[model samples]
Target: MKKIFKLSLPMLVIISNVSVGISQVNVDDRQSVENAKIVGQLHGLEGDTLTLSYWVNALGLDETSSYKRAFAPVEQKIIVAKDGSFSVRIPVYKKLQYFSLKSNRQKTIWKEEYFFRKGKMDDISTSASVPVLNWSYFILEPGDDIKVVLQHGQMSFSGTGAEKIKYLNEFKYSQNRPKSFQSFRGDSLSTIKRISYYDDLQQFGINILKKYHGRISPMAYQVLQADIIGHCQYYRYSSASLFNSYKDPTIRRIYLNIYKEQVKAKALPLLEQLSTEVLGLSKSYPLFWQQRFKVEQSYLLYNAHGDGVETQQASKNDLFEAVLNLKKGLLKDKLIVMNCSDMLKVFGQVQVEERLATALTELQDPTMYAVVKRFRDDFSKGQLTYDFTMEDVEGNHVRLSDFRGKVVFVDIWFTGCGGCVSVAKAMRDKVEPHFEGKDDVVFLSISIDKDKRMWKNSITKDAKRDPKLSYQRPGAHYSGDKTIYLRTLNGSDDPFIKKYVTNAYPTLMLIDREGKVFAFSAQRPDGGKAKLLIDQINDVRKL
Candidate 1:
């Protein structure tokens, strides 16, 4: 039986608004070594090339956008000249930073399922492409100097903090597409239309900051009101599993009694503005305080497993008593170093050093205890793995520890992936005919395709497979059928696809036989898990 409730337990006791109207912009840690000047102009592209990144450190907003595949530790390319000017100065890592300038040949190569779709924008900039003539977020400071131009594709700005992001390049891109929510339409009409679709997107971003009040800059108007309440509480706790596939307890107590008689008293003051004093001005406040601490730790494990609430399972001492029922400062020390960087990426590093010894005195921010002790000295389990180098399809290169004593099974795909062609048609029908002739098993596959002719037309095709041109043709002769193709030699910026794909993909690893890592998310020969990926490659070839 499923009828689950706790749609984030009635917006969990309206967040104690730490007197909104956000603050924190004092600067001085030697103003991150001061510099900031960015003159611009690029009328007709001329000698091309442009880039101007930022985000030198917002500790990757305590990760969770499929662990944000690392990049942008400050970039800067530019080139342009032939009469269409350009200038650069950068360095201000503190007071009101955020930048982006684009057009390094309108680049676009990224896929962690496009960060949950629908025009994803934090003033645009994801695995690129969202700048019909760029310059996103753009709010500089230390020793200010601004001034930009662009022309045909229209973009402008002028001297010293030009009216703070000139209404973000003239706003109205249909207000970053909000207002969605309809799926499970019963549990109180999908819980009062998903709390009035995030209170009409926090009153349409406070009526566009009261129609551009004081022309925007009090910390870019609280980072656009914490990017409209962190995209309405990150799409309301990532659409809290819309009533976990409904189990009809009389149509869920008849629309949870019409959401406690017509939407629980005007939706608890629009879910008390999901406050935590919009912490240190927006990179959307730690992804809206890690989606409001995973919706109050899933309403404290659905009130501690009340009647088989989907087979309860939230350990690590139930995530340290649901973050010791939070209250302490700096957003509970940045959600205790983003709960030890999501418990060292799913319970590893000996369970985040045994919950950092009871989370080391509730970790009082020394930059969140040195960012969870640098994610516990960069977590490692079975270790070894990263001998990277890939490129096959004639350009040769290969290397993952030169398949040392085999047992590989890598996968990691791209180039129009329909779930990597349904796990390469379940590894060509039920796991390569059960490892027929396994010389210590291999399989491989890689890709992260940065267009080596679309990764050699998606692994050198075979024929007769057009489920509507299977995501740009893919039938999988992944290297003459049995699978062994490669390609990531710097494709998705390969540092072995950013240290084992945290910008996800069809990523499935395994390794063993001394090449180490026995599964950084393995098992996926599609639906009928191909005899559980052939019994986890025969239990990692019997270790």
Candidate 2:
């Protein structure tokens, strides 16, 4: 049997300090202070398995060498008892960070996030009687009893820091009001009206902060303030994209005639206002502020370069000129790496390599430059994909190398991904039919679903069957030779997934006949892309 090794608190403290190089305060000179431990008793959990994971910002390199931000999971699992109860303690490194608690049953899973702080114990509990997963957080200082009650969809806390949690709950509830303001209905509103609407929302958020003035912690209040500002900026940027409708020629012509210049006029002022607010909040909340800055910069750049077309078709000199124009900082360096990497993916290595080489010269941070170099080394084409074994819905094992000598189209997905389901439907309706008789081609669906039953249900039953609402199929049934196979990763944190860097859901990849990766990130199985996959397969066959 494989031995399971858990990280002790001391080990976690050492690792966290060493890996991130964050400062540490000595409490007694014998033990250095580190992450806070959260202990909780969960009652009325419907699932047999529970998963706890925290988010960390990770840099992802796509097939094009473009860098994208991904929140990678550092997860741990707990076993629930027969009476729907479990006790767990999780360590959190950041003072203000988010952690998810996921309960997995045979048919369904319940997941929710809780805010945490280091050097504090958060005792939270929830019951199945509550319609939603509502948590009551309380700060415990070494020697306090832990308990929380779920009443009428609200959590009641009685321990230390209870008032703060109550205020947080109220704030969360207030923010949950209808999001209809975000929706844009075909340019019914003028450009000025749209900008004013976002401004009003920003003011409304400020009013929320003022209403809860003395009730919440100062840190929590600042975080909420930053969140509101970020949301307002995002809404304005998103509204611009919606109003433009670049894909719809008729809408584009109509919008450009009336509101194009007016919208462009408002963009700079809005971004400038956001910049002032973000800069003010940067000292107290650097990460949140940096994230907001990144988004705003992306929007500004997107608008400046004719939306996306100019950037997509930009030459090496044009790309460098656009990148170098941005203000110098770690954020700007990251953005340049991201854009250059994206260009490489969309335009291919030959077209974007010169531009990437030029951009690398501008990168002052060794860590960021190393990320780009590692991505380039790992994601290059014609490289052999990481081989691994996974079990089919039945108890049988299947190896990736088993499909050697045949071209493989691998679909990396999970049960909860809606995009993955839609692509699966497309594969069933379109891609599968086109290659009905192809012997050299194969379709492999690899699900990283934590629940085995969900994976089995998806393949054996109709695509329309809802596992939550209906009965699940017992196991998958597939012929050995026809190329279509449904397989599941052994666990949520499977090494195979980490090796492939399969961060995005519904990621498609096409493997050459000799098991070498042809397209590291292939087109989704939707629209005419399915036909394109067939064409590529035929072209590969000839070669």
For each candidate, the alpha-carbon lDDT, in order, equals: 0.58, 0.49
- TM-score of every candidate relative to the true structure: 0.30, 0.56
User: Candidate 1: deviation at residue 248, Å?
Assistant: 36
Task: Indicate the residue-level lDDT of 428 in model 2.
Answer: 73
Superposition TM-score, candidate 2 onto the true structure: 0.56
Error (Å) of candidate 1 at residue 236 is 18
Q: Assess candidate 2 and give its lDDT.
A: 0.49
Give a tens-digit lDDT track for model 2, residues 1-543. 321222122223211212120011111222222343433344555345655543221222111211222223345665655554555443433233333444564223222322223323233433333224432222212222224443443455555434444554554455443222322356434433555555666666677667777765555455456555555554454444443335565654454443344333543332244443233222222233333343344344445665444322333335446557766654455555555545543444344455556666776434445445545555567778778788875668889899898888887776566667677766776677777777788888787766666666666644455547443333232212343555555654465565454335666777888878777667665655778666766666665
Model 2 bad stretches (over 4 Å): 1-69, 76-168, 175-201, 210-224, 243-248, 253-325, 328-330, 333-374, 391-396, 413-438, 445-483, 490-505, 523-543
Once model 1 is optimally superposed onto the true structure by TM-score, how far is the C-alpha of residue 409 displaced, in angstroms?
6.9
**In candidate 1, what are the lDDT values of residues 1-543, reduced to their tens digit?**
221111111010111212110011111243235777777787877666666555533423222344443222345466778887877776665556666666655635332211122322122333746434466555666777778787886667888777666655554344363534443433444555565567676676567566777765565666666666665656555444233335554543453344335433334343345455445446555555565454445445545654346521343446556665777655566556556545443443355566765565676434444444434443455777778777787988879888799888888788777777788777877888778788899888888767676566567665444443434664453533677788876777677766666445677777888988776667676767689779978988997
Best prediction by lDDT: 1
Q: Top TM-score: which candidate number?
A: 2
